[model samples]
Target: MNRRTLLTAAATGVAAASLPSMAAASPAMTVKDTMNRTALYRSSARTQLAALRWGSTTARGLLEQVLAHQAEVNPGVNALATLDVAGARAAANRADQYLARTGRTLGPLHGLPMTVKDALETAGLRTTCGSPDLADHVPGKDADVIALLRQAGAVIVGKSNVPPLCQDLQTSNPIFGTTSNPFSPAHTAGGSSGGPAAAVATGMSALEVGSDLAGSLRLPAAYCGVYALRTSRGSSPIVPTRGHIPRPPGWLTSSDMLTLGPIARDADDLDLLLDVLAAPAPADRRAWRIDLPEPVSRTLDGQRIGVWADDAYCRVDTSTRDVLEQVTREVRAAGAVLDESSRPVDFAASNILFQKLMYATSAATAPDAVFQGEVKAADAVTEDSPSALYLKSRTMRHRDWAKADEERQKLRAAWDAYFETHDLLITPAAPTAAVPDQSSVPAPERYITVDGVRRSFYDQTSWINLASPVGLPSLVMPAGKTRDGLPLAIQIIGPYLADRSVIAAAKALAKLLPTPPKAPGLMA
Candidate 1:
C-alpha cells in the first residue's frame, strides 16, 4: 500500500482493543529461583551474553528472568505494551540448541532478551505507535534495525509504549495509557521513547533501541536515570521515524534530523550496542562504509571540555545547575582543561532555525485540513511573533524551506569550526528532573517552573536543540539527583560523527560521580 492510503486506512481502522488476537501459545518454561533471577537481572548485557556462551545460563533462563521481572513491575509503570511470551521462549530454545550443538555463540547479543520501542515495526507482532489508527497493524517484516538485532542473536520479547503518533513529551496514549517514571509514579517517564528507558531502568529488559528527534531519547534516559545515545545523523541505517507511524506505512524517508540509537543502563552497553548498529544499509554498503574515529583522550587528564550549565535564553532549575557545577569542579580537579565561557554559534539564532526545521518536518504528517487551518492562522498573525513563526513554518512554501536550509548549513559550519578545539560540550538535558505527569492537559497549556519562573511548555527542548539540527553525536548519563531524590542528567555533545569520543567521556565521568541507584522495588 502507498503511504497516503495506509494513513487513510489507519484513520478509519477499528480500535486496538477490539482487534483479533494474533499471538500464539507455547509450552510454559519452568521459572528459575529468586537468586538466579536477581543475578541475571542485575548483570549487564555483556555479562549475560558471556554466561549464555559458557553454558552457565541458558537463553531460556534469561528470557524467564526478564518475564518474571516484567510481571513484578510493569503493572505500576505500564512500560511494555505487548509481550510476545510464546515467540520469545521459542527463539531462546533454538539459540540454546544451536550453542550446545556447535559449541560456539551465535553473535554479539547471543541469548540476550531485549525490548524495542513500539514506534519501530516488528514482524508478526502488533507494532502500534500508541495510536488507535495502527493499533491492530502488524508488519510482515522487521524494521532495518530490528532485523539487525535479531541477526546479532538478540531475542525480542515485546514492544514498549509510546505517545500517540509520538508527538508529545510524555508517554501516554489511548492505546496503552501512561508510562510512569520508575523513580516516582506521579512523574512522567518522558517520550517518545519513555517505555524503553523505563524498561531498561527497571531491569525488565537488557537493552533497547530508541529514536530521537527532539530530546525523545535523551530526556527519557535522564528522567529514568539510564544512559541514552543520540547518534550522528545517518551513522546507522536504522530509519526509525520512517518505519514508525505519523509517516504511515510504505514511507521510506524520515525527518532530516531524526536518528536511531541505543538506551541502556551504562555507557559500556551503549558502546556495545553502537558497534552492532553503526553500519551502512545493504544498498549503501555496495559502494562505501562508515568507520568512526576513536576518542581523542581516554582519560579526563589533558582533555579539553566545554561546559554550558545555564543560558540566558533557557535557564535550568537550581538543582539541575548544581549537579552540572559539581561535574565541572570534579573534571577540573582531575586535570582536565575546562572552558566555561566558550560557546559554538549563536544559541538564539540556532534555536529559532531548529524550530523552523522541526515544525516544517512535522508538517508532512499533518492532515490536509489541519495544514489548511495552520495556513489560515499564519496569515492572521504578525510576521515576527512566535505563533506566527510556528504557523508559517508549519505551512511554509518551498522557497521558505530553501532559505531555512541555507541557514542550517551555516550553523553546521559554525559547529564544525568550534569542535576543532573542544573534545565535548556538556549541558543540562532538561530544565529539571521528571515533572508531574501532564498528559491530560493540552500541549499548548502545559508549563514548567524553573527557578521561580514560569516557562513555555516547549522549553524542555531548548538546550537539547543544540545538537539536533547539526546532527552532532550526543549522550545523556546520570550526573546526580535532586534534593527530592529524582534523577538529574547532563548531555555530552561531541563533534560530528565522534560517537566514540562521547561515550569515552561518559565512561570517565561515571567514575567520579555517584553510581545511579536502582529504582525502588525494581529488584525486590
Candidate 2:
C-alpha cells in the first residue's frame, strides 16, 4: 500500500489488528490502567531493547504494544497527528529477523518504538509544521536527528502535533487541531513540542525527539511531567534547521537560538538518547570530532548549586514557589552548598536582549510582503518605544542584528563567569503550571491566570527564554505537583558543554521528590 493509504488505515484504527500478537499472551497491564499511573510508561526504551536482545519479547510485539497504546488513548488527547503503523511494523519485523539470524542487537536503541514531532521532516511521512499551507507536504528525506535515531534502531511510528510553524505557546494548528493535556483535556499540553510531551507522558509513545526555541521542549515537558534536555547550542553536529519548517523546504538556516533534543519519561532515558544524538553529522565525520566532558560531580554533596526560583521580572505562582522552597530544603539537607543570593546578569536586560535576538532571527522566515509591511509599520514608532520592539526586531538591518549579537555575547560571558563558582542553577520552568487550553484564541490575545492575577499569554515563556539566548544546557524534570494535581517542574541550567552535569543534577533531584500522579480520567 502507499504511504497515504497506510496512514489512513492507522488513523481509522483499522491497522491495530495488523500488529503481531504477543508471544506469551499472558495478562498484562491494560493501556487504560497504565495511563492512570504516575510511573514511567509500561516499558521504557531501555527495557524494550533489553527484552529484544534477551528474546523475552520480539520487536514486533513491542511495536504492537506501542501502537495499541496509541490507539487506545490518542482519541481523547489528539497528541498524535499521523500514524505510520505499516511502515513501523515492517521495520520491527526486519529487526526481529536480523536478531534471530545474527544473535546480536542492532544498536543502543534496538527495537524501540518512538515518535517525532510533526514539525520535523520524516522520510515518507507528512510533516505539516501545524500549517495548512504544508498540510499535505511529505519529505523524501529524514531530518539529521531522525537519521541518527534510525541508525540506533528506533522504529519510527508517527508524528505528533504542534502549533502553527511552532510559533505559539500552546499546541494547535489548522491541520491536526489542538493537543490537550493528557492529565486534563481542559488544559493545554504546551507547545510547540506539546504533542510529543503528552504522548510520552501517557504511554502513547516510549520516547520523543523535539525541537526547542523559547522553551518549546522544556515547557511542554514541564507541563506533562516528563524529562527534557535542551541541548547546548551547536554541541551536536546535526543541523536542526535543515528539516525543520518555518525555514521552508531546502532552506539552509534556522533560528539562532533553536535546538533539537530528546523528551522522555525519566533522566536516564534522556541520557540514553543524548549519547546517540551527540555525534557529528555525516559531513563532519572526516575531521571534526566532539568529546563532551563528564559532569562535574555525581553526588549533591559539596556541589555549589544556585537557586533562582522567583525573580522580580517574573513571579511564579504560590504552588510553584512552594515546590522550589521544598526542593531547596532537601538539597541543603543532602549536604549540597546552596546559594540563593548570586544571580548571573540582570533578568530584565537579558530578557529584553533575548526577545530582540529571537524576533530578529525569526524574520528570515517571513514572506517578502509581510517583511516589507512590518518594516513600514516599525518606521512609524520611536526607536525607544517598547511597543515597537517586536516590529523593529523583525525588520532590523544587518547592522542592528550585529549589535544585538554583541549584547548576547556579553550575556553569555557573564553566565560563563557565574558558572565558574556554581555547578548548576535551579529555577522555575514557567510562572505557572499548564493553564487551560487557549488554542481557540489568537496567540496575542490569549491570557493566563497566575495566583488569581491575569497575565499576558506570553508570560509563560518569559523564564524559559533566559537559557535560550545564552546557549546554556538546560534540563526540566518534574519537581512536584500543584494542589490541583498539575505537574510542577524546575529547570536545571549548567555551564556550556556541561550537558551531562545538568542531567546528573536532575537525576539527583528526582530522587528527592514524590512520584508524580497520573493524569485523571484514565481507567485504573
Best-performing candidate as measured by lDDT: 1
Whole-model lDDT, model 1: 0.83
**Candidate 2: residue 445 lDDT (0-100):** 76
**Clash pairs for candidate 1:** none
Displacement of the residue 108 alpha carbon in candidate 2, Å: 0.9
Off by over 4 Å in 1: 1-38, 234-242, 384-386
Model 2 alpha-carbon drift over 4 Å, by segment: 1-41, 234-241, 383-386, 520-524
Model 1 TM-score relative to the real fold = 0.92
| Candidate 2 lDDT over residue span 1-524, tens digit each | 43345444544542323333322233473433332332223656677677778876677766665665566677788888877887898898898899999988778888888889988889998888989889789899987778888989889999999999998888988777889998888999999999999988888777899888889999999999889998888433233446777678777667878888889888988889998887676677799766778988877889999999899788899999999999999899988999999999899898889999889988887889989988999999887886699999898899999999989888999999999999889999999889999888765678999889998888898888888898888899888998878999989999888999998888887888888766542333
CA-lDDT, candidates in order:
0.83, 0.82
State TM-scores per candidate.
Answer: 0.92, 0.93
